[model samples]
Target: MGETDKHRRIMTALIEALIAFFKNIAGVYVSGNLMLYYEEGNPSACVSPDVFVIRGVGKNERRVYKLWEEVNAPDVVIEITSRSTRLEDLGNKRALYAELGVAEYFIYDPNQEYLKPPLQGYRLAQNDYAPIAPDAQGKFHSAILNLDLQIVNDNLRLFNPHTQKFLLTPLEAQEAVEQAETENARLRAELKKLREEK
Candidate 1:
């Protein structure tokens, strides 16, 4: 309820990029702001993450993810953080993810005022979580997702170093298509004029 506009925007962007990037991959499920019930029948042992990815599972929608039934906890979990949730995100949530054996845990403070670096990550190792060190460019590499997590212009961004491009959100993808169409139309007109002149 206390989520800001930036938090919501970042969450949506992550969700869009994850879907677009992983849609063709088999057994990859991405979701946001969903209840992950760790205990099979105990509703109280649940955590609602801002964004999560579970591998080796069907990509179908679920009202709530039951870990026992799925046989896998989220491989990656990301939180769009705020000052109010700082304690929870860094403390309880961190412990819970480690306990659940989430391979990667990331938190991004889009506002830039809450966290010192505004982006941080942890990787589960030997049942304990280890800090994920940022690279020279300040991007934290996600081995599970095979992507780099960073902040771009005050927003959480996923960059694919392999493609040498940042994964686009849904709106950004739409804008790219529109821009390409416009450029193509202009080039077509110019080509017709050149042919007529010749």
Candidate 2:
């Protein structure tokens, strides 16, 4: 089954934001909706996550992600679940990620049509995945990325704990830049008026 437009948009937006966030970091690869082949020869053993981040791997383009080639599975896997993929994302994929030793697994339901809470996080514990407890405001923490996952106004957002701000999409980032420029212009004008008065 194909994903709805909203699902695709959310996946793209989140992936872009994560990539931009980690752009300066070395040995970090961020990908969206790419096929991850666990085994070298077996095509059947593969899954394409909505978004994945692998630390300690070269950030290069590849047709598929071969676990053996990289010598490591993705450190973090995020699935943007729709109604059709909800079960697989939460069940089979969850087990596969745990088995692969993925440190973190996250699921987000943009439409809230599948998951009860719409956002969930799991951490690998003792070779098994344990559910990550949400904070008081229902924000789940990601140990791998060191960020908070929150659902705000029916949208999934990543929050930087240290910066205490939400990571913005490319469009949102552009808007922020524009707003800052406008504010700076206003301040400059005010300063000019004050200097003239002096």
Candidate 3:
């Protein structure tokens, strides 16, 4: 494959992994770089979010997200910094998401070069992004998904507050479910013994 194709493939894999991680913990829809159509054939009107989450939406993979069809924009939009697109991601993209009524906006620097500290989060208030403070662990809480975002080992990870654990990918989640069932069975057997004694 060519250089551009290789890069796109790598990024696509990363995004898919991240989306699977988030979906396992929460009933939300995750999409990456799907075209948002604001105008026909208008280069300036096209906007694509690197990664976005929409709670309580379809769980199937989509080719392209049409705002008119979806009836609502994403609740949380994440942008991964790239050399060519850094300015657009931080400036115009931020404004576009805000104008579209996205509840949260997140940007991360995978290279950790340009935007020092690598991650920035904002919650929409009064039609604009309001900076959100990261927690002691340098994690930002997402108001839309009620999850936390943290950079762990150079990859952005999502933490589910409800479970008090970092969200897992589909495979991890399946393992977790199996583990939980085993524990429950063990507890049931113990309780049965106690009842027999009584």
Output the number of the lDDT-best candidate.
1
lDDT per residue for candidate 2 within 1-198, as digits (tens), equals 577887887888888899889989999999978889887779999989889999999889888888898897899998988878888988899999999999999999888877988898889999888889999999999988988999988878899999999999778989999999999999999999999999
TM-score of 3: 0.72
Clash pairs (backbone) in predicted model 1? none
lDDT of 2: 0.89
lDDT of each: 0.92, 0.89, 0.76
As for TM-score, the candidate ahead, 1 or 3, is 1
Residue by residue across 94-193, what tens digits does model 1's lDDT show? 9999999999999988878888888999999998889899999999999999999988887789999899899998888999999999999999999999
- Model 3 Cα lDDT, one tens digit per residue, 1-198: 122453354346446655766646655787776777765456467677777777766778787777767776788888877677779888988898899889999888777877867889999999999999999999999877777888887767778778898766455667889999999999999999999999
Q: For candidate 1, which ten residues in a row score worst on lDDT?
A: 1-10
- Per-candidate count of clashing residue pairs (backbone under 3 Å): 0, 0, 0
Clashing pairs in 2: none
lDDT of 3 at 184: 100
A best-first ranking of the candidates according to their lDDT comes to 1, 2, 3
Worst 10 residues of 3 by lDDT: 1-10
Residue pairs clashing in model 3 are: none
TM-score for all models, in order of appearance: 0.92, 0.89, 0.72
RMSD of each: 1.9, 2.3, 5.6
